[model samples]
Target chain A: MIEIKELIKNYGEVRAVDRISCQIAQGECVGLLGLNGAGKTTLLRILACLLTPTSGTVTVDGHDVVRQPEQVRRLIGYLPEEPPLYLEMRVADFLAFVAGIRGVPRMDTGGRVQQALQRCQLEHMAGERIETLSYGYRKRVGIAQAIVHNPPLVILDEPIAGLDPAQIVEMRELIRALRGEHTLVLSSHILAEISQTCDRLLVLQRGRLVGSGTEEEIAGSSGREFRLEVLLRGQRALVEQALGQVEDIDERQLEQRGPDELLLRVVSSQDVRAQLAAQLVGAGLQLLELRRQRDQLEEVFLKLTGSKEGAS
Target chain B: MREVGLLARREFVAFFRSAQGYVIAALYLAMVGLDFNLRVLGGGAKFSSEVVSGFFFELSGFTMFFSVFISMGLIARERETGTMPLLSTSPLSDAHIVMGKYLGALLFLLLITAATIYMPMLIMVHGKVSAGHLLAGYLGVLLLGGATLAVGTFGSAVTRSQIVAVFVSLGIGTPLVLFWLLGRYADRPLNDVFSYLAIHNLHFSPFRSGKVHLRDIVYYFSVIGFFLFAATRMLESRRWR
Candidate 1:
């Protein structure tokens, strides 16, 4: 379990993290989504015990980060954006070294190192120097080091940044594999990345928690209507004219796929898919596809960040 | 204690793996070898004691000079390369990290300084050498090296550039060396104080002459202790930044 209360971090005069509070339960995977300079890195660093918060408190598994730093460090593992590693050391040697520093017992270190290597799929490159490996392999080594001691809580900052497409898929799979074993907190500016891997999202804007919930909750809190896309067997003009009759649609688009196939997309404040299907059939058109299109992750990110840009 | 051993092992292995460590060793050996030939052998000194004393005197110079390079990157390189965060975030305390790093650099210094023993032994073949004299001279060099390396550790901890670390260590060391001269010109009480505080004069002279004074050993340890304490404080204060 992790809890942060009124966490504040300041860099000179700039408030990097401004009095933010959050709680994460055991075995939960939470994603921190934010824009550039949004205090995500600062918050993560503070949680990792790499940087001290200017005020407030953070505790991991009942250990206070400030008062019991050694205990907190033993319970948590951190992977910074650049993946702190000694390039000269071989992958296996580096992981073993980290495991030692992470306070893993002497008798169990070898098995722990092996487990981390196998989990990250780094067994093949275990003997290779980190500097000699490709970027993807190096990242795997980074993740391996973080988990080599099997800390209960893992905090990853921008783990997917600068990774190739294939490597991204590999990393996502690795994160998913950790679901049962560790409570993970990962931060990213990329929305799609968070939505794909994280169980919940904490959206921050200008050093403030603007939203925190599941995808549906965030979308609902945005005060924006869901989009409904419908396909009907009728003239596009008649369906377009009928959609225009609906009073609450913010916008509507009608497209003709064939002589009888009409595609209707409507942005409204409410769920009108059922009413639209009935209206299409009552108007002598065969109803086909009638479903509300969930807002894209990108659109949700924009709404969360764009709304704060003007006021902040 | 195990953490200390692990960190020290890591640092010591790094020195051997990089060409820079061998280069520093080679440079110190070349200087000591040239000095033994030119200053000790070239001088028309018949007594083995004179030759041994000359060798110890010259070796101290190399020890002091090379100690700067040996400890120059102890903490500064980590700060520059951003590896300090890795150590800082570990479960170890600042004191453990500082002590481990200091031990690593000190061990490397001992290895390089010990390698020069052959030159003094070669003198032993031609002229009779006292085991007591040899041990005393080597101890002096180690003490001087330890003090200078501690100062360098302080320099590294206080800055992020190895170049600046070297300059700062030298800047602090040179003044202590000159304090011997200041002692000569000062009045009674001030003269006594300055002479006692002088790094090379009062503290290092007895060892070069085959005399192991308890005061000299205590002085070197005190200097090392003071600087290491400063380095530890500097490391701890960085958490606030």
Candidate 2:
């Protein structure tokens, strides 16, 4: 339900967000993938109406962000990188306060707060002061406040940035659960970190929209040729000898995995898994596994950004 | 308007929820008490009316000082701790946020002012003081305190550092309160303007003397309104910046 056209935001001499544009359909879970300084936060802030675009138009539904900010604000729930929490306030009270400010009707504020509490699984800590909670719980509270008003669009900037592995898994589940209820937009520096949680990805590099689509689509758009990996039970010579007959095998690597098992990586012009599997079994070799390379996207992402993996 | 009240109540209650409130209260009461014992009530056999008036006159200075302390964190701390986005992204206008914050700090200032009533009652215990004198003096202190708090809010709005906010507010308010002195040495129309702009002497004196003038009332409110409006504009400017 959001449309942005050629959005640009400048911080004086620094162009934080360049002329970039994208649309977020209703109930679409979109991840803004980028490394540090990729303008993810700046772009999200523009969509959240916390910052006005330097040029071009951004509208939520039919309301322009600059001209009709209050209406735009009413339609959004934004969670900044740092959880906007008042440490002295209790969990439920903080959510209630957020609900009030977010324009939830006073009569329904209690119920709304409780619903948000339950959504974030913070009902048990409802009465606890914010200062007494751990960082993970605080992030949950941040999410709770964002959903308290039940806005149509929920913008979470770096939602999983500071979480431990277990917390990240829980947060992933939490974000996944929110997909059908609202249009979700979150940012992360890693490609695989949020790819599984989002329906589509908007890859940014140095203030530009470099790539946008699903994982396979992004991988395909990256112009990567066909590739596959296979595991087999045989001597290297016999495996290589069997695969030497395949005409489409442009390049291949055969590495010994165990005494009898061998690992084979193949790059080819066409599908050769069926032919390769038959060749292995025909040569009196046991075929253990054959599939597409799983980490191709990671390589594609690194190639696109031209930066080392996990640089940010 | 309803949002203003809700936000104000939240901020007002926040003061007592932490140790900051009690520390400010304790320090303020002690400072005012020490000044009252040594300066207003200790010196000589002054008339009860003069003593109460002098108490208010001295109390106004402390009120302004403490008002700066109270309001320094109103918005600055929010920005420092990353909570400003919650307010900035909300449907509430900047004016509403500023008013909510101003009213909250004002309520706390008034509460602290209320706590100082014991000092006045101490005057009442032995000396004969008119209730009108006491009330009018208190009205002046509250207005002066509130006006300074608005200045502090403006200061807080412009910067993210509370220390800078305190200094900026003091830097702003010190000159306004000292305008009467500037008027004393300056010439012509400038003198009249400077004297009128004086926040304390020219405006607050009447209220301290148990007489409420519409002009002084207008002046205090104008200061409050002008600064609060400036603060709201500062807050709104953030979206563009």
Candidate 3:
């Protein structure tokens, strides 16, 4: 549904979005994983036709963002990091206004606004003035306005940025509900939020696409180290020698946990537990408590970006 | 046009929804009433035409100020409140958005201009006045208000702060009105150029006297068009910036 090629956006001396390229499929929910200053917002803005790429081209459904912005804009709905809202307007009225400008047929605008309100779960607050609503509801209104026109591709920049835990959960469900019907592309520095909400992940680090795929695929991509704790019925020195024989084992620390048992912690470039088990059996050792230690999203993100800052 | 209308209607209604809009309108009406009671009536019995002319002449100044007040927030406030993305990402062109905002402010100005009709209508009850004259004077008021509002809209587009927008508007317009004074002291061709460019004196005088010259009409539209176009250009530049 979206194609971006070598998109570079520069502001005089500062290159906000460097040579980044990625394709998002129709009906696929793709999350752009990056910390602040990782060019997530700049990239989304370029796709939404709000910013022109300095050197590359971005197209939504076949229309070029630069050459045919109005056409591309018609197919995509965008929510910026901060929800663009008029506080004085009522929830329903504001959605209607957005729908009107988005070129929803005049006769269909009401129905569209109603559908948006229902989908965003804002029906209870439809008549409430936006200024009176809380920040979370305002965010929901922002989502409502974007989808009010029922665009095929929805680009949300940091959709769950400033929400509380409960609000984040609701937002996740709301974004997930929009998955199959509309091609969803959302960006977030939080690994768990992006991983749980999106089907595919594109990890951006310092304005470059470092990895792209599902969580497990990215975990197993390359250069990822797996930590394993194996309890063995052997001497510490013997367990260390056996683990040393296993290939891809980067480091090993063996400790005597019991009379005939040793707790061997092995850090390998890959999942070398099987190799270690085979080698340990050949060395006359019983393997116990053998497992790979890695959190699903955090491990994959740390492996791809190699940054501890976005662990949140 | 439909999009412009939709935007304009929203803007016009906003004036009723907010206390600031009503406060400004009340203050303007109070001042107009006071000026009518003091300067026009207290001066003594005068020609009905003079009273009418005097009203339009002074009302012209207030019209300029009113336009500035109404238009200061046109584009600037949207930027300030972070709502510009709603308009910027839409399928509409910059010209349409600018025109929509201008028309919305103009609608409010027109309503405020309409409210002052009672002051002119009182002339009909007390003395003889031509309907053509009232129409001509009102047309001039609309044109002057429109021209000033367009300039203010341009100012609002160039800045994100409404106060800065106000000063920028007055900075552009105050000189145009004052150019008429500069024309009186200048020599030959320069004087002619300055007088021709003066938004008020040479252009608006003919309309105040119930004479609708096509030249003055074109001048008002040209001012309105040029500024609105400039505002649209500013938006286009900022959108990609």
Candidate 4:
């Protein structure tokens, strides 16, 4: 379990991490979402005991970070955005070194190193020097080193950055496997990755917490809204004219599907699909498909951040 | 202490596995060997004790100079390559990390120091020299190497660039070597102070002359302690900033 109260960090004149309070229960997977300079890295560094908080207090497994840092560090495993690796060390040797420095028993060091290698799916490359590995492999080695000591809390900062599609899938599986073994806190600017991997998220904007919740909860809590997907058997001119008459629709995108049928994407202030269907029918146009896009979390995210994008 | 040992072993292994250690070792040995043959062996000498003392004296300067090169990259290189965060976030204390890197550099320095034993042994075979003098002279080199390496470790801790660390270490070490000259130019209280504080002339001269003083041992140990303490403070302050 981790509890952080009023965690604040200031770098010279600029406040990097403002006073923020959060808690992570044991076995929870939490995602910290932020853009550049949103204090995610700073927060992770504080949790990992790499940096001390300016004023607030953080505790992990009942040990205070400031008062009992060794104890806190013993309970936490941290993987920074850039993995700290010695290019000259082999994978197995590096993991064993990390395990030893982290106070693993001498006799059990090999077993722990093996376990971490297996967990990160690097069993084949255990003897290879870190300098020879690819970026994805190095990242796996980084994660293996972090978790080799079997700490209760694991923190990964941008674990999936710069990974290919297949590597990303494998990494997602690897993170999921760590669910019961440790409480995981990961920070990423990729919203889709967080929405898929984490059970909950804490969103930061300019060093302040703008939102925090599950994806559905964040989407629902923002406000009432609906996204409309309309297929009309009419020309683009008639479709645009019909969408203009619909009240409470904020934006619309009309694409001519064929000579007659058109596809219309409507961002509405409320659910007006029934009224739109009736109006399209009354205007002598066949309403082919009129349905609300279910679970528009991306829309909610963009709305929270004040952005708009259409189907391309 | 066990953690420190483990870290030290890792660091030492890194030194050998990469080209940096071998390169430094080869270059230092070449320089020391060339200097020994040209200045001590090729040149005329009066006594065997003077010849051995000359060998130890010459090696001390090289060891001191090379110690900085060995240790300047110990921590700062890790910081530059973004690897210090790994150690910082580990369960080990800052003291463990600093001491481990220090010992790693010192052990490598000692290894290179031991390699020079052949040059002294060659002298012992042909020349008449006492065992105690040889032991005392080697100890002097080790102590001096420890002091210089500690200064380099402190330099590594202060900055993120190994080049900058080399400059900082040399800046601190060169003045101590030149203090003997300053002692010559001054008078009264200041003159005595500078003379006593000179790293080589005051403290190391007795060892080079086949005499071991407890005060010199204490002075070398103090130099190591003072710089290591400063390094630890630099690490702690960096966390706050």
Per-model DockQ: 0.57, 0.78, 0.65, 0.71
Q: What lDDT tens digits, residue by residue, belong to model 1 across residues B46-150? A: 688888888888888889888999899999988887677677878888888888888998899889888989987887877788889899999999999999999
Chain A (alone) TM-scores for all candidate structures: 0.85, 0.87, 0.78, 0.79
Ten-residue region with minimum lDDT total, candidate 3 chain A: A303-312
**Model 4: per-residue Cα lDDT over A126-207, one tens digit each:** 9999999999999899899889999999999999998999999988999999988899999998888888899999887666
lDDT of 3 at A94: 91
Note the Cα lDDT for every prediction shown.
Answer: 0.86, 0.90, 0.87, 0.87
Q: First chain of model 1: TM-score?
A: 0.85
| Candidate 1 lDDT score at position A16 | 86
Error of 2 at A219 (Å): 1.7
Query: Model 2, range B57-174, lDDT digits (tens) per residue?
Result: 9999999999999999999999999999998889998999999999999999988899889888877888988788889999999999999999999999999999999999999999
Stretches of candidate 4 off by over 4 Å are A224-299, A305-312
Q: iRMS values in order, in angstroms?
A: 1.3, 0.9, 1.2, 0.9
Off by over 4 Å in 3: A226-303, A306-312
Indicate the fraction of true inter-chain contacts that candidate 3 also forms. Answer: 0.69
Candidate 2's residue-wise lDDT over A1-312, tens digit each?
888899888999898887888898999999999889989999999888888899989999889999999999999999999999999999999999989988888999999999999999999999999999999999999999999999999999999888999999999999998989999999998677878899999989888888888876777777765688888887778887798777788898888887878889999766687898888889888888888876766788877777422353
Better of 1 and 2 by TM-score: 2
> Clashes in model 1: which pairs?
none
Each candidate: fraction of true contacts kept? Answer: 0.44, 0.81, 0.69, 0.85
